[model samples]
Target chain A: MGLHMKRWTVNPETWGAVVSILGFVLLWYILTAVLKLPRFDKLPNPVAVFSAWLSPHPQFGLSIFTRGYYLDILYSVGRVLAAFVLATVLGVGLGLLMGWSRVFFDYSFPLVETLRPIPPIAWIPLAVLVLPTAELGVIFITFIAAFFATVLNTLLGVRSIDEVYFRAASCLGSRPRDVFWNVVVPGALPAIFTGLQVAMGIAWISLVAGEMIAGQRGLGYLIYEDYSNLQFVNIVIGMATLGLLGYGSSALVRMLGRRLMAWEGRRRGGAMA
Target chain B: MSAGGALSIRQVTKVYDPEGVHVVAVDNCSLEVASGEFLVVVGPSGCGKTTLLNVIAGFEELSEGEIRLDEGPLALPGKQVGPGAERIVVFQNGALFPWKTVLENIAYGPVVQRRMAKNEAQRSARELLRQVGLEGIEESYPAELSSGVQRRVEILRALINEPRVVLLDEPFRGLDAVAKSVMHQFLLDMFERTRCTMYFITHDLDEAIFLADRVVVMTTRPARVKLELSIDLPRPRDHRVLGTERFLKLKQAALEAVHEEALKAFQAGERELA
Candidate 1:
């Protein structure tokens, strides 16, 4: 708690970022109001947008934000959640397999190399054509984006491990599987996290693109619909939600990583000192 | 911890990258280490001293021949390694797990071997920490300790398992003079208490003379035992031994044996460049 307080007070970066976020809001307000661009005819002013955001569905006597927007937000979150989970399972599992054995590495390398260069957005056309459902296409695109980076990062993590660790573990009477599970996995986790973080960002980008193309629901679909109808305020709201969702989810991951690798943090801090 | 096992390494030849210009590491090496003997193998760097130690520790595959403990093969034929607390190798780097505390690091051997329950391992770990003069710092991470303390922890980690034979591979490479001296004393004290057989590899002639009951000098890669001198020095030796006549004499002899090897090692490297 003291550390948090100290950080809050003394950390220029933290305060700077917060200030910049508010600055962006002010700038956004000025751009629409004071500047009064020709585009303002359809694009509602900040006050109107904020009011719309605040009361998106005022007919039911409840706040529109709390009711209608909540569902859209939930729908967006659900799609990301499903996609992220699928990406993680496929990524980590295949990554482990690729890392552990030479045969798997060789077998997967060519195919992975081919797939990785093509952006997940590029898969939208193929996914739409090949997959039966739009949701499946979105998920496939997210998975493709996440899976390759995870596998590659995991492989690199495994390769970079000190040979002595394996020798030491073996001499300590640890079995092959024990060595892999106990030493290799934990040792490689930091790098794996790097992959996961990148994969998550890519997954978000992919989901957005997929939804824009063919989505029936989700934040991306909502954004696209708002854009075509010139519902500028709603579009801004959708983008803000997406930004918050992506960043918030990533921060949660970082927190989980810290808890899981409490020891690693200590080690790194010591080494730095 | 009393004198227990005799280690006999016979015709042990280690060649790296065999089938493609194999570089011999230990050439037809044969040696007998009596139970509880503290033998230090001294040579110039690149003389395969560490390779010989690794072969004994079962971390390296010997091109030919065998290592036996108590007349039975320690490392099986056509196989690289064998079993038991007969051998434990301490690397040049302390190689402590940065993640584990001093207590946990020392407890690794017991936990790995399943010799003690987790709670029992903690108890044993505390005892080992105390023995190594790190009792108060048991909760401290390996990264938190000084180099001297870290080195002590490494020794304690190795000794925690009570291995019959312990291999020291340039164990004091990074330590300052005072830290090295402390480690020397600690090692001597542990040896006296345990009477476990030891094989220490060092490029430091003084360290070799300072600790070993016997000093085996080696030549450069395709390394062979050039000379083996019995130290017959008084036990529980102190730092004052370094100034003593007998200690200086032993140091001189160890240096002489490796003097030509040092030159040859350098020359061979130059030749490779040419």
Candidate 2:
């Protein structure tokens, strides 16, 4: 009887999440299909969107089984991955240097602070004019969006490391290089991962916007093109696909973060238990 | 190993100037620890005992006089030396790397110093863990361990370096009575095995009496060394010594010295509040 009771006691967090997602979908369906609200009139219903996604040779000239759909996904995913990786490397490197050395921080901080608050979209015209290709320009915009978030967070992370750790490292006879690798990197990791998660979100947002404005092949372009043609179902398909892809990529980043920061996870788990 | 571990502090003073207001932390603190000596400094809260420790550790600059380690000029006023492996400190809170496991934390000192290979460091870390009665939790992170276990791991992290001098800043401050007592015993045992000259600071009189061969009591801020009492307790002492007449005598003496300073600090705090 105790075992049965234990098994039945599901985690409230999990149940809450399941219920919220289902309710959201149900509400969306009701507002569009049943209530037939004026605002949601043009918005494609869940059934039309899902069926369009599954149908071979749908209005967007792509479906789940089609090569064109996969190609669009590949284009979007590839751009985001490239831009995200580039931003991570550059951001972490610059942030660590700025954090570690007062001289470096003094020199760079003014420029970074001036540039950081400017939105990535505002740089589109400048990037397009300056860069060699439109693809590079789009990637540059995506990179900028992710880069600032990562750099600022990584810098904050490094600065936030307790002074005690630095003193302890010094007493342990850690060389400058050893201190950077051992103390600065790992100490800044939690904040860096937080930065990465935020950066991933920004990366997808910028990538989609950049694609819609400039490009020809991604899910963003599909949405734009389908809207122009008044294939409303394909636009919903593109929107849903983009949402899933963004979620999946962010989840991947989160999963990697959990794996790398197992110590932090254990500490939180211990606290909860 | 204990030949040249002497630390000589001669009229060392630290002054902090915040917006042209001069606040002296350590006032002409002159003391010495001989090779293989266990010296504990006891003082009231805000007595600048930690400032003295930081000065010895080379983390803070001395405003007056100098400190010498092993008969060599270690740090002078206005030109502070950085912390070195020779004088490792075990802080009040065990500042173990939260990311690293117990074994990795212990191995950190040697690996960073390039004194031992990674595998060799890990091997010796395991041995040290066993000696400290922390055998099975080698792979545990600092947060995963109990406060007692974390303190033990921190001690090994310092000891594994086999530093010339070990400075402890209230190393067992936040533990339960049982855990604190166990740690006291564990520290004593480690001292026996490795006679690393130790400079320990604590506010707890009983802890000072239990741990120190000699205890230095400091006055309230602008702290100065008020009294130094030597303990003649037998070697291999344990919790039983806490109840001994000699131990009680030492504790009473240290407490009296500390209580006067504490009262002065309390009155000063009241004045500030007023």
Candidate 3:
């Protein structure tokens, strides 16, 4: 009976994910290849797209085997990584200070509050004009997209720490600096990670949008270029690649969160009856 | 009063205003504690027992009067000193840092103060853990331990700093009966060994009688001292002492004092509601 319950409970989630993905693909194939609806007919079939991707010298002037394709991937990944890292460091530092010191919060919070609501995409024209180069503009847009989420969430995290913890730290003879490091930082970490995950997603979105609007190369640029050239198969491949890379980078953030928050996981697990 | 841990609280008062509703929490409370003395404060709930502790710990400002440590004026009305390593409070809820392991929590005070190197702190923490009979749980987080174990760890965390005075705010309030009894014995043992001056606040008369060298009972809200009783119970006190005639007499007297204050507070609450 226990074994039967285990079997029923464990595999359903795994099976559900697998089945849903397969079913989605099958439906895509049926619409494009089998039924051949008007809009679907205009789009490339799954087989055509896969075959194009597999080709030695693909139609869109790149493939997995091509150095150009790798470069496109590299450009996108590097931009995201650099922007995300910059956003995280700045966001956390500013957030901690803003949360811990009333004077700092009073001085900066109004400016942050005013700017945070303005969408990262909305800054594109201004960024392009102000920044020295188009690449820097794109990076700035991506950085802004991630930075606000991290900063706000990290500030909230620091504020949310119980008052008693501060009392405990002070009573333990923690200097102001030590309190920031030992109590404020660790206390705010779980929330900061939540911010990082969100920031990672937003960074990708802004990067893609920025790339599509500006010149040069990235997965986003590849997709837009293919669409303009009417290479429908390459567009599909580019879309697929973007989806996979977004999922991969988000997964990396989640993995790091899990490693850092092992203690929290154990604590929460123990709390449950 | 003993030599090292002399603390004098002279006519201290604390008042608060919540949404412009004036409330007096502590009223003209005065007390003194000697070095290595185990002094317990007993009172009815909402009788400002905790407020008194908070005032003494320098976590809250006094509205009147002064507090002196070793005959040196420590804090005064409207200008309070912040919490420091010389005095640490062990909260009832075992406010152990959920993120740190037991060893880290115990070692935090010394390491943060730069009084000891990290390795030395760890070594001292290990010794403390052994003394407290919590030897193997150093690597475990507070959440992984039982509530009883957590309380023990909290005490160790406070004591590791060798604070001049340890303030315990009903430190065994939520434990099971068995766990509470064990903690009582453990606390007795610890007090015997270290002889650190402690100012313990509790609503439990039995607990006050069991642990205190002297017990101070406080009156209802806007609290002040109602009674003071010294327990001359023999040392190495254990479970066997609970049934003694002298212990029973002390418990009965404390209960009477607390019950009177509790009744007054209850009637005052009823009057306010009406």
Candidate 4:
């Protein structure tokens, strides 16, 4: 609610973070705004970008006051949401089957290993050829990144459990289904969440690259358009907004993870695996 | 809580032939544990005491022979019945669920398999905790507790199941000396209160003599019973009993029996390596 309330006034401890952020901006201001060095003269200074970010009436017709800015944001967010949800459902389901059943692991894991290494952007040309719409192709790129991360991490989570727990559960008379739900599910959840955090970051990165190459309407597309039209300040604004959105999405994932795994916060070791 | 169960093991044999390694873990071993008796088995490291416990606990199938639990066939000639609620094992490393609260872990077995209501199981769990004077920390997770407390909670978790037999496989292997003695008293108190059949396995001869009514020593590998010595220590015994002449004599007998197997195991291991 309050990134806007006060500009770094309350806490002494948090001043370090404020200083770090301000220092980066100061270096950029010196490089371009003051010194106007060789390559720096071509790029927009932070002062120009900062004012453009706050301007209701930006010189380039896009800013905090512009409706087109939000429309671009909404498109990117919508695509990420659709892709992220599908990736989670597919990845976690596949991971559980692979982790629990020997037959499934033997049959599918080799193929998974074959496919996992291809970068998401590598799929752009094939996805565009196969998918009906460019938007779908961009989403496919995002989904691929998130799906691999989630599946691999969830599998590791399930495998990291101690074998004694399984023995103990069965000795306590748990049926196979009971052991699956009581032991495997809870034991793997912490690692699954770790995967989700990594997935969120990758999903956003892929979304931007996919938009630049294949998308027509999103923050990624806006950056490409700004560059083509020589609206350099607007391009920086697009990149900054995308960064903020990605950070926000990761924070949301972490919040959900914390609520689900409230017991995890109490471990004396003080780190989530 | 006093539903003691007698276990009869007859000509039991276990062979591990994975990838043609052809290792026999337990060979033609036969023993009977009377109902309510505290029986401790001592052997050299890697001498397969744990394999014997695993057989009785129904985690492993007998390659030959059978085990009976109170007249019921536990592991028979052909059928392999998996582990059940009637036999519970307290593992060497603590196995309490790190995710569940102390009370929730204690209540899990009864609530899951026994079909007790959740509230009813919790009530019994609290009562068990109160008996151990760990009353206020019922809501704490296992990771939040000290190792000593975690082991105590694990034992309470097993005891709450009211299993006919409780197995301990080197359960005190990693505790410090001070913690080990306190755990000794704690275990004895629980045993006296429950009177459940106990099948404990350890490499420590002193622990065996301290806790068991009878101690069985096994030979090095392809382990078979080498000697069985009765511990004549009185019931409700304490640390002072460790200083008595009778305890020392019993310890001496066990040490002598185990020392020979330890040496044989060393020689066998050396030959395998050489």
TM-score of each: 0.89, 0.95, 0.93, 0.93
- lDDT, candidate 2, B171-243, per-residue tens: 8998888998998999888888889999998888888889888999999998888999989999989889989
In terms of TM-score, how similar is model 3 to the real structure?
0.93
Please count the clashing residue pairs in each candidate, in the order shown: 1, 0, 0, 0
Q: Could you give the candidate ranking by lDDT, starting with the highest?
A: 4, 2, 3, 1
Q: What i-RMS does each candidate reach, in Å? A: 3.1, 2.4, 2.5, 4.1
TM-score, ranked from best to worst: 2, 3, 4, 1
Better of 3 and 4 by DockQ: 3
What TM-score should be assigned to candidate 4?
0.93
Candidate number that wins on lDDT, 1 or 4: 4
Model 4, A130-230: lDDT tens digits are: 99999899999999999999998888889988889899899988988988888888889999999999998999999999999999889999999998999
lDDT of 2 at B272: 97
Off by over 4 Å in 4: A1-16, A122-135, A269-273
The digit string of per-residue lDDT tens for model 1 on A1-273 reads: 555444425478888988999898788778778887777545566676667667757432223446546776676677777877887788887887788889998999899899889988888888889999887888888778877877888788887777776666666666678678867787788888888888888878888888888787778888888788877677877777789889998888888888787777776677521
Evaluate candidate 2 and give its CAPRI docking class based on DockQ.
Answer: medium
Q: Is candidate 1 or candidate 4 better by TM-score?
A: 4
Better structure of 1 and 3 per DockQ: 3
**What lDDT tens digits, residue by residue, belong to model 1 across residues B89-179?**
7778877766567787778777778788767988988977776656788778777778888878888777878888888898999899988
- CAPRI band of model 4? medium
DockQ of 3: 0.55
What fraction of the reference interface contacts is present in each model, in order?
Answer: 0.22, 0.82, 0.77, 0.67
